[model samples]
Target: MDKFVTRSRAPVEEQEVELGNLPADPGLRIPISDYHPNLKDKVRRAYLQKGACQPSHNFKKRKIENLLRRFNLNWFNEYKLWLEYSVEKEAAFCLYCYLFKSDNKQSGDAFVKEGFDAWNKKERLDLHVGGPNSGHNQARRKCEDLMKQNQHIDVTLNRHSEQIKNEYRIRLGASVDCLRFLLRQGIALRGHDESDGSINQGNFLEILKFLAAHNKEIDGVVGKNAPGNLKISSPDIQHDIVNASAVETLNYIIHDLGDDLFAILIDESRDISVKEQMIVILRYVDKRGHVIERFIGIAHVPNTNAASLKVCIDSLFAKHGLSISRIRGQGYDGASNMRGEFNGLKSLIMRENESAHYIHCFAHQLQLTLVAIAKNNVHVGSLFNMIANLVNVVGASCKRRDILRDRQAIHIYEALAIGELASGHGLNQETTLKRAGDTRWGSHYGTLLSLINMFESVIDVLDTIVDDGPSSEQRAEASALLEFVQSFDFVYSLHLMKNVLGITNELSISLQRKDQDIVNAMKLVKLSKLRIQMLRDDGWDDLLAEVSMFCEKFNIICPNMEDNFQMKGRSRRKVHQVTNIHYYKVEFFYGVLDMQLQELNTRFNESNMELLLCMSCLSPNDAFAAFDKKKLIRLAQFYPNDFSSVELMMLGNQLGTYIFDMRSDNEFLILNGIAVLAEKLVQTKKDMVYPLIYLLIKLALILPVSTASVERAFSAMKIVKSRLRNRMGDQLLNDSLVTYIEKAVFDGVLNESIIQRFQHMKNRRGQL
Candidate 1:
C-alpha cells in the first residue's frame, strides 16, 4: 500500500467518482495501470464502488458439437461477487482480478486479459480460484482489503501524506511565480549575500518572503514548515526556473513564427568580458499580418570570421528547428566577412538559397555616407576637427563645465529680460557639449546643434581657460580654439554642414524604424537627394546671410561678399584674386553638397533602386495607385521558389482581379501601407482569395530595411552582461537575455507552463 501510487493523489472523499460516466464494458474501459500514476487509486476505488457489470438481457448462442450453448446469466450466482460481463465483447471477466491485478502478474489469464466466455467449462472458474498463494486469490484478498477503508491508522497517514504533497506544490509554485516576475523585469535574481538573516537575500528570496507574508497558505509551507531539501530557493533552482522561462518564451516565438519565411538580422559585438557574441533577430509577418521582429538568441563565437559565424548560425537554426532555406533575406553591417563576394555569410547562404538577398543596413550605410562625404572635403574636415578640440577644451574639466553652464544661464537670463530670447518650459534647458563619435555620424550632428546653442558660453569658457593659465599647453590650446571660432570660414563651414545634416537626419531616422518598408524608404532617399541638390542650387545666399549674422552677433568681423577672397596664413598679394562670393558659395557650399549627393547616389545605386522600385509597386498607398502589373509580376520572378512559372502566369491573372476587387471596396480605399493592406486582406478573407499576391506582400515585409532589432539586442546584451555580471556563463547569459529582450512574447507564456517545463527538465525534490 505504501508504494501503491507513485504520484500525488487526492484524499479518498475528495476524489470524484461519477458512476453514470464510467464504462461498463470491461473490454472498452481503460486498464487500471494505464491511468496516470496519481489517478490510479482513484480509478480503482471508482470501479469498486460501481460493483460488477452483469446484465440480465438475453445472451447470444453458440453451437458447440451440434449442441447450442450460450453465456448463462445464472453463472453470476455461482461466481457471485467477481463475475462481470462486457456487453460490447459478450465475454465474462473477473472483477477482482481486473481491479487488483499487478501489471506483471497473469494468473487468471483468460479472465483478466482476453475475457472468458466458455459456457460449458464450469470447472474453470473453480480452478481459477486456486490456492491462497495463487495470483487470483492474492488479487481477491487485496481487493477485499481495499474495500475495508475503515482502518483509522492507514487513513490518517494517507491524508497526512496528501497534505504534504499539496504543501510542496504551493511552495514550488511560489518560487516559480517569484522567478517569473524577476525574469520579466530583467532583474538579477541573486545577490552577493543571500544567506539567511541577510537583509537583501536577493530579488528571488525577498520577493518570495513578501508573497508569503500576504498569503496564509504560502506562509505556512515556505520557510520553517517546509522540508529543507524542498525549499526550492537555491541558485540552481533559480537558474532552472530562468532556463524554463527562456525555453517557453522561445517556443512561443517559434510558434508565432509558424511556417512562414523569415529574414535574419544579425550583428556581432564584444561584451564587457570581451567575449565576441552575435545576436540574431527574426523578422516575419505574423498571422495577423503585423511585421514582427523578435530577438531569438545570442551565441558566443571565438572569432567573427565568415566561416565561424556561418557554423554558429547553422547551429542556432538547427537547435531551434529552423531551416536555412526559409531565410528570404540577410541583413548585416558593412563588415567584409558578412557581405564578402565569395566567402561571406550572405554568399554562403546564397549558394544554398539564391533568393536570400543581402542588404547592408541602411542606417549604417547613411552613417558611412555622411562620414565619407564630410571628411572628403578639406574645409568640412578641418571644421569638425576644430569643433572636437573646442568642445574638449571647454568641457574638459569640471571647473570648465561649470563655467560654461553658469555663463549659458546668465546669457539666457539676460536675453529673456531684454526680450531677445523666448522663455518656455523645455526651452533653454541646461545642456553641455556633446563629443562626436567616429562610428555614429548622428552624434556629429547633435554635437553641431549643441555647439550652435552654447556658442557664446563655449567662447566664454575658453577665454577663461586662456586667462587662468591652468597650464601653458591648455592656455595655448584654448587660445587656438578661440581664434578658429572667430574666423568666417569656421562659422560658414559649421552652418553649412548643419544644414546638410539636418536634411539627411530625417531620412536616417525614418530608415531605422522597425515598421519601415523598402518602398517608402527609397522614396525618402530620393526626397533627401532632391533637398540636398536644392540646397546646393539655391541655398548659398541664405547660408551666407545666416553665417554673417552669427559672426556679427559674436563680435567677429564679417567679410564683404564683393571683397577679394584672401586665404588664411597667405599674403593678400600672393593669393589669387577671387571674389568672396565665389570662394564661399562655389568652393565651399556647392563643393560639400556635391560630395554628399555623389555618396548618396553611389551607396543607393541603380540595382538597389530597381529592386526597391519593384517592391514599391505592391504599395497600397493611394488605393493601390502605385500597383503595376508588370512590376509586381517581376517581383514574383525574384523569388522563383515561392512562385513558379505557372503560378507567375496565374499571378498575373490574379493581380488583375485583385487590384480591381480591392479598389472597388471602401475598406481597402483607406489602406495606407503594405502592412496595413496585408492585415485588411486577412480580415476580409481576401488573402485566401489572392494567395499569390499575399505571398508577395509577405516577401516584401520579410525583406529587412535595417538591422535595428539586432542592434537593440546587442544593447540589451550590454545591460544583461554588464561588468558586475561579467562572469555569467554563456548559457545563463543567453537565457537571461532572451527573456529580457522578448518580454512581450514572454509575458504571454503562462507560469504553469514554465513550472511544467521546469519539472520535466529533470526530477526535482518536490512536484511543481
Candidate 2:
C-alpha cells in the first residue's frame, strides 16, 4: 500500500534508522542519506522507537600530562534525550543530530559525522545544546516531528487525494482491459482515421468506448468526464501500458526459471518491412517438472552475421540479469553463420562456455538431407523437374483445371463401375497438382501422389492443348511433357520417391512436435534409417513390378527386363552394354536409396547418437525399466562442473539405491518420462534426499531437442507485424510480441500493478 503512493519528501532530506537492528556503536553506523528514499521515514521512526543507543559501561580513565581524566557517564542524565555513548570509539554523540543533521557546516558536526570523544572538556557538552535556533535544537525538532506519523509529507498529500486515486484506478483498469484484448489477439491498435467523428476510431479507443458505455463506473472517470490532462487514452500512454505488460511477463518467466540451467533456441528472419529480427526462446524444466519453452524477446539486428548476433545476444542477457555461463545447450538451423565449426554463433558461445553443446535443428537437417540427395541423382532430378512442368502446363488456368477435373471424374466413375477402385466417405475428392517446395520435402511426396492419381486426366488436358492450342509454344511444350509422362524412367522415379518419402515423412513430423524428447526423437531417427536400409536391400523387385504394372495399365511400353539397355539419347552401338536389370536395379534403384541412407548416417553420426542413448537411460518409461546406473553415471560425467570426483563417487552409489527405491515404490510406477519423474521426486521430497540425482536430472533437461519454439515465434511475428503495420518501431514490436506470445503470464498480471508501473515510469498527470 505504501509503495502505491508517491513519496513527498526529497531523498536527501530524509534519514533512515533501524530500531531492532540498529548499531549500538556510533562508530559503525551509516549515514542516513545512504538509505533508500522510500525507506527513509521508516528508518527515522525505527530509531526514535528504540530511544537512542546509550550503553552504561564503567568509565575508563586516561592519564593526560600527569593528570587523570575519565569520561563521566553522568552526562547522560544531563542531556538524557540526545546524549548517547559508543563503546567502540569511546565517544559521546548527540542522537538527534546524528539522525537529522543538515548539509550545511555547523558547530555541532563533532556530535554527528566525527563521533565526539573529548571527555577532558566537561563544558563542551553544554555548549553543544546552544540556542533555540542552533543545529542541535533544529535536529531535535525534526526527530519530534518524525515520531508523529501524521506530520509526514507523504501522508498529508495522499490523504487529500483519496477520491482522485479511486477514479484513477477505475480509468486505468478500463485501459488495461482494452490493452489485454488487443495484445492477445495480435491486432493493431491504431487506424487510418481516428478522429472523433470517424465511425471506427481503432481497436484500442473503440474497445474503450464500448467498455465505458456499458460500465457506469468506467464512464464516469474516462473520456470527457475525466480531467483533461489525466486522460489515459493517448498513444504515448498506451505505449507505456504495453511496455509495462511486457516487463511484467518477462519478469514472471525469469522468476519461474529461478537459478536453474536453461538452453537457448535462436533464429532470425525478415519482417514485413525487411528488418532482420532475431527471436530467442528459453527451454527449461519448471517447478512442476514440465518442459517449458518461453519466448523471451525479439531483437532487431543490423545484420545476420555471427559477430553482430553474439553482441546482440550478450546485450540481451545483460539487460535481463542472465549469465552466459548458465547456458547448457544451443539449438539453431544448419546455416554456416549459425552452426559452422569456426566463427559461427554456436562456436562463439561454445568458446565462452565449453559446456554449451550445439545441436543443429533436426527438422531442418532432415529437409536439407532429403533435398540434397534427390538433386544429386540424375533420374530423380529430371523426374521432379518434369512433375513441376506437368502441374504448371495442366493447371495453368481455370479452363484447363476444369478439363482436368471433368476427365478425372470420368475415370473415377468408370473405375468404380468395374470395381477397379474402392468408394468410401472421403474417396475420389478433387485435388490439383502441388508444387514441391525446396525447403519442405514432405510436399514432394504429396506432389507425386497427386500425379499418380490424375495421370490420365493430365494426359487428356495435354492432348487437348496440343489439338486446340493457345499458341505454338504452348502446344510444343504440352506435347513434350505428354511424351515424358508416358516413359518408364518417369513412372519408376515417381513410385520410387513416393515410397521413400513416405517412410521419412512420419519421422519428419515427429521431430517437429513441441513435446518431443531427445531419446524418442533419436529412436525415430534410427527406425527411419532401418526402414530405408530395408528398402534398399530387398525392395528393388517390388518397386520394378509396381512400375511395370502401371505402364501396362496406361498403354506405355515396358522394356524387357533381360534386354540390353541403352541410354535415352545414346545409341546402343556406342554406349556401354548392360542388361535392363543392371541399369534399372543396380544403377538407378540402388543409387537413390544408398544416397538417402548415407546422408542420414552422416548427418546423425555415432558420437552424438551415443550421447542421446546415454540420456535415454534416465527415462522413467515402463516403471523405470530403462534406468541403468552405469549409463546415468556416465551422463553425469558430461557436465564436470555439476559433479566433481567426490560427488560422482557418491552419485554412483546413489544411482544403485535410487533405481531399487523407485522400482519398489508404488508412487513412481505412474511416471511416464524423466520430466514427470523429476516432478514426482520433488513432490515426494526425494529431491532433497538424493540431491545429486536431481541435479543430474536438471542438467539433462537443459539439453534442447528442437528449435520449434523459436520457429513458432517467427510465425507470430507475421501476424503482429503484417504489411499494414510494417513501419512499427522495434521497441513497440518487441514489447507487443512479448505480451502476445506469453498471454498466460500477462493474464495473471494485476491491473493495479500495471498502473503503478506506468505511474513510476514518469510523472503522470493522474494520481494512481
Candidate 3:
C-alpha cells in the first residue's frame, strides 16, 4: 500500500502508447514482384547504393531428401548479382531485371515482380538468365558494366595496345639509336643550323636520318613519317631519353652500392654560366670489389661557403634518398672554406656523422707539396718563374714554335753526328716545352725534362732572339736571358730541383691513378720520402757532375768550384764572399732539398701515416698482406659505434678463422678488392661469419684516396655547360653529364626499359 501510494503520482499517461502504423525501414523491406517500373527502379537504386542486404538469419529453408536443408548460401554466392532473396516474402528475387527492366517489357514474374517460392523448381534460375541479348542478360550486362569501372587495374593494355607499342618502339628505337651513336662519338647534339634545308642539322637529327635512310623499319617510324606529337627526335624527347639513361645508370650504381658505407669525393667550381656548382662523386667498393668512384651528382649552389655547401649536400642526399650516416669519408681540395676546422663543410658533415672523416685530396696534396717546397726558397721559386717565362716565350706563336723545333732538329743532328745523343722511337719524337701549372701533376717534371732534352735547341733559340728580336729592348732582354740561362748557376739549380722532383713525380702520378689504393699510395709515399732522403744525401755530387757534363756538351760556361760565391742579382754589398762549394753545396742544394723533405714529412706526418697504416690493413690486394687482424682491431677504434667492446673482442678470432677459410675458398682467393670481397662473402654466405672484419674492410675501402674523380667531373662540367650552352639549367646539365660520363652504363640499358619509363610518365594517344 505504501509503494502504491508513492508511485501513484502518474497513471496511464506516464507511459507512451502507439496509436498508428509507422513507415517501414528501407533496409528491412523486401523486394516485390511486378511493381511500377519507377518504384522498383527507385528501390533498386537504393539497394545498389546501399549494397547487397543478404542477411544470414533471414535466409529461407526447406526440407529436401528427408533432410532439413536450408536454402544453400552457395546459390546466392554463385548468382550474387541477379539472385536476391527476400525475408518478408520468404522468396527469391532477381536484382538485374528489377533495376534495369523497362516498363513496356514483360518478363516471367517468378523472380522479379513476384517473389519465387518454388524451391523445388530451382532450374528456373537458369531460365531467368535467358539468352545473351535477352532482357535478363542485358540487365546482367549493365550490372557487370557498372562494376567494371571500379576495378583499379585500369592500366592494362587495350586491343590497340600491341599496335601502339610497336609504333612507339619504332619511333623511340630510331631516336635512341641516333642518340646512342652521338653519345658514343661524344659529338654535340645540336648545330647552329637545324633547318630542314640544312644538310647537317645536328648529330642527333643527322644520325636519326642516316639510320632511317639505312633501315626501312626505322624510316617508316621516325621524324616526318611519325605522328606529329609522336616524333621522338624532338628536343624534349631527346632529353627525356637522355634522362632515362642517366636514371637507369644511377639505379645500377645505387644497386651496386647497396647498403654498404661509402665516401664522398667532393669538389666545387664555377660552371660555364659562372654558377657555383658542387660535383659529388661516390667513392665506394663496387660489387666486383673494385674501388669505384662514380659521379653521383652535380649540385648548384648560391655560394661556396661551408653552410651553403652543406645545405646543398644535405638536399642532394635527401633528394636521392641517401643517408649522411652512410658517408665514411669526404674528399675535397684543401681550401679553408672546405676544410676549415670550426665551420667547414667537412665539420658540418662530421657533426651529423662522426665517422665521416675529412681527407684532403691526395692528388691536390701532391700538387701543394710541389708548390710549398718550390716557394719555400727564393732560388727554387725564381727557377720555376724563369722556366714558365721560357715556355711562354718559346710557345707563344706557332712560327716561334717551328723555329724552336727546327733548332731542336739541328741540335739533335749535331749531337747525333758527334755521338752525344741516341735516337729512338719515343726518345726523339718532336718535343715541345710544356707549360708548368700549379695544379697540373708532373708539369714541373715535364718542363724540366723537355728543357734538358732540347737544351742546345733552347740555347740556339735564345741566341737568335738576342740577334733578331723585333726591337732593341726585346733583343737586350733576350740577350740577358740567354746569358743567365747559359751560366753554371742556372744549370745547377735546374738539375738540383729536377732530381728532387723526379723522386716524387711517380708518386704524384700514382696517387692520381684511378685504381690506386690507400695501402699502395701510403707505400708510395714512404718510398718517395726514402728516395728523396737518399737523393739529398747521395745526389749532390752526381747532379753536379751531370750538370757540368751537360754544360760541356752544350758549350755553356762552367764555373770553377774554388771561385768566390756570388748571387745572381746585382746588389751593392761588401766583399764578404764565400766559396762556390759552400754556396752551392751548403746554401742552395741543402736549402732546396731540406725544405722539400720538410714539406713532404709535414704533409704526410705521423697522424696521416697512422691513418694510412690503419687503412692499409683493409687492402684485399697482395694476398691480403694489408689485411691484418691485429692492426684491424686497432683501426676498429676509429668507428666505436659500429664496433664496440664485444665486436672488437670477437673480431680478432673471427678474422683468423676467415683468413684460414678464405685461403681454401676459391672465390675468396680470387677476390681482389674490398668491393669484391664484400660481395664474395655475401655470395658464399660468410658475410655474417666475419662481419666485424668485413665492416672494417668496407670502412677502409670507402676511405677516399683522392678527389681526381670529382675534379674530372668539374672539368667535364666545363665541357657540358660550355659558353655556347651556358644558359642550360642545372638539372638539364646534370642529366646530360650523368649519361655522358657513365656512357658505359647508359649503353648497357635496354631501349625497352627506357621507352617504358617514358610511357609511364604520362598517358599519351600512343603507348611509348
Candidate 4:
C-alpha cells in the first residue's frame, strides 16, 4: 500500500484565479471634432462596452454657486438606461448616442462627440428627454431594443441583414402573388400537361411567369436567370411556402385563443379516392360578439369507428400543441359514431374533459326532425312524394325545363297585365322550379314556394304534356297527375304545409345562423312554437277560405263544411257523421302541428336549454345585460377539475368585480365576440386579478356554437384536394387548405419574413 512515490509529497496546491471586471476607461481627452468618424466608432465601442467610468471624486469641477457643481455623481444613478459619464474629459455622454447616433446636426452632438461639460446647466437633463419624436428618444429606443435578448444582433442578422431582407422580400413577394392567384380563382396548382411546349402549366407556374415577365427585378433573380437552383417556383418550394403561411395563420388563431377554453367542430367524409378523412374547425365568438369559424385542419384516418376517430383526434391535437382538457364543447353530426352515449367521439372527449359537452348539430337536428315527421305522418309524407314526382316528370329534361319556364313567363306576364300580381324589381325576374330532394328538408319548402309562385304555369305545362302525348302512357300519366293536383285535397295539403313548415322553417333558418346564441335560440324556439299554436287555434277559417278560392279559380269542386268526409278513392269506407271540418282540422292539422312541437321539444330538451341559457352570460350584446355572476359560477362548477369548490366560491366575488370593471373600462366598451372579450380581459390585467372568472368566460367562449365550420372545411376540402388531386398527401393538403381558407392572415405576412424562414430551413442554391 505504501509503494507510491512519497518523495514529491511537498505542498502542491493550485494557484487561485481572478476574474475582475473589465476596464472602464473613459478614453483619450481629444476634442470631439478632432476624432475622425471612423475612429470615433472604435473609441466609442470600447468605452460603451467597458461601461460608464464615473470617478467623480477624482475629477475637478466648475463652481456655479458657492457649492462646486461637479458632474452630478447621482445623475449617473438615474437615466442609466441610456446615460454614461466620462471622467477623462470632465463631462458626461450618452452611452447609447455615442455608439449609435447617426448624425451630428441634431442637438449639437454635445453628449457624444464633445461630452457635455456644463455642470451648472444640469437642468439640461429635462431638455435631454425632449419630445416623443426627439433624436435623443430615438437613440434611446435603439439602445433599449438592442439590449433585449430577443432583439439582439446575431452573425446572420449583422453581416448582410439589409441585403438579405431586400432580396428575400422580392422572392417571397413573387411566390405569394402566385399563390394568391391560384387561391382566388379556385384553380388547381399542378398541371398534367406542364412542360415547355404546353401553353398553360397550371395556374401557379403561369402566374409566376406572368409576374416575372413584367417585373425586371423579379426576372433578374428568379427562375432560370436565378443564381444556382433558387428558382423559388418549384413544386416543393411552392408547397413549403404555402405551408409556412398556414403555420403563421394558425399561430395567429392560437394567439387569439390563448389558454382560454375553446370548442371544436368536426365532420368526416370520403375523398375522391375513397379515403375516410375528418375535417376539424374552430368556432368561437370573437371579442366583437361575431361568430368566427376558422377551418383548422384535416386528419386522415384508417377508420371512422368511435375509438379510431378519438385516437386520430388526439394525435391531431398533440401534433398542434392543443390540450384536450381545454375543450369546452364538441359539435358533430348525429351519427351514432359521433353521438353514441358510451363509445362515440363526444363521450370519449367528455371522459377526459367532462365540460366538453356534446352538441348534436342544431341545423342537422332540425333537418332530421323535419324528415322524420314527414316520413312518419301519412298525410304530409304522401303529399311531398307527389310533389317530388310531379317535379320530376314536368322538368325531366332541358327541353321540358325550357317549356316550363316559357309557360311560367307567359302566366307571369298575364298576371302582371291583369293586376293580379304586383310588378316589382325582383318580382318579374326569370325563375325556374327548384326540384325537391327527400333528404333536404329545406328543398321541400323551396319547391312548394316556387310552385305557388308559378301555380298557373305548372298547370299549363301539365296540360301541354297531356295533349302533346309523346306516348299514350305519358299522356295517361299526365292526365292523372293533372287531375290529382287540381283536387281540393291537394290544394288543402299545399297551404297547410306551407303554413306549418313556414313557421318551423323560420326557426330552422334562425337556428342555422352562424351567430346563433343560446339566448336567441331559446327565444326563436319559443316564438316559433307560439306562432304554430296560434295558427292551429285560429288558422282553420283562413286556410279553408284560401283553399276554396284557389279551387274556384282552378274550376275544382269545393266541398261544403257541414258535409260528411269521404275518402278520395273508388271504394270509400268512412266513419259515419264525421264533418269535413272535424276530419281535416281536428285530426290532420292538429296531428301535424303537435308532431312538430314534440320534435322540437325532444331535440332541444330542458337540459340543453338550461346549459345554453347559462352560457349566454358570455353574450356581449345589450351592454352585457345577460351577464350573471351567479350563473357564471354555476357554469364553472360544471368543470370541477378546473375549478375546485374553493375556487368556485371565490369565483362569485371575482365575477362581480370583473363585470363592474369590464363595464367601466373604456377598452371593453366595444366588443365583438367572446375571443375578443378574453383578449381585452387579458390586456386589462383582469385575467390575473380574477383567474376563475376568466376561466369561466373562456369555457363559455369555447362551447360549440355550431358545426357549420366543419361543413365549411369539408366544402373547402373539395376545393383543395379535388378529384384530380385526390392522392395528395395529408399534410400537404392541410397546408393548402389553411392558406386557401384564411387568405386574410396571409395577406398581412411580410414577404421578406417567409423567404428568410425558407432560406434558414436548409441550404439552398440561391442566397435569398
Top model number, lDDT: 1
TM-scores, all models, native as reference: 0.77, 0.75, 0.75, 0.71
Query: What would the per-residue lDDT of candidate 4 be over residues 1-768, giving only the tens digit for each residue?
Result: 011112232332212100011123233233323345444433443333334444323344577677676666577668755566543356677756655564446645777666777788878976877898777888767555533323334433534456654665677678877886676445688777665577767778787878889998987666666545445677777776766566666767765654445678887888777888888877665554345667777777878898988866655553343567667788887889988889988888888778788777766666776656755767677778788888888887787789889988888888889999898777678887778764344767788888887777888888988999689988888898898888778888888888776777867776666656545555666787788789978988898888888888879898887888886543554445578888888877788778877887888772366677777787666567788877777777777667888887777787777788878866776775555677777766777787777666666655664576666666677887787887887767777777777777766666655565554433344443
List runs of model 1 lying over 4 Å from the truth. 1-160, 439-441, 569-577
Residue 9 shift from truth in candidate 3, angstroms:
66
Per-residue lDDT tens digits for candidate 1, residues 567-614, read: 876677787789998888877777778888898898878235666788
Pairs that collide, model 4: 285-674, 286-673, 287-672, 287-673, 287-676, 288-671, 288-672, 288-673, 289-672, 289-673
Sort the predicted structures by lDDT, highest score first: 1, 2, 3, 4
- Model 3 spans with C-alpha error above 4 angstroms: 1-165, 413-427, 570-576, 606-609, 617-630, 656-688
lDDT of the candidates, in the order given: 0.79, 0.79, 0.69, 0.68
Select the stronger candidate by lDDT from 2 and 4: 2
What TM-score, to 2 decimals, does candidate 1 have? Answer: 0.77
Q: Candidates 3 and 4: which is better by TM-score?
A: 3
lDDT of 2 by residue, 1-768 (tens): 011112224343333322223444555566666567666556666566445665534344677668877678677777879887665466778888878884345634888866676677878888888899988889889888766544556656655377998898899989988998999999998877666688767899899989999999999999889888777888888888898788778878987986578889998999999989999998888886677889988988878999989877765664454556678888887778998789999989888777787777787777777766876888888988888888888889999999999999999999999999999999888777888876553778788888898898889999999999779999999999989989988899889988998888878887876656677677788898899899989998899889989999999988888998868875767888889989889888888888888988888772356567788888888887888888888888877656789999999989888888988999898777676788899888899889899877876776776677787788899999999999997778988999999998888988777776665554355554
lDDT tens digits by residue: candidate 3, 34-149: 33333443334334533343433324467766655445557867886567655445567776676566432655566665567666666778887888887888876765554432
Clashing pairs in 1: none
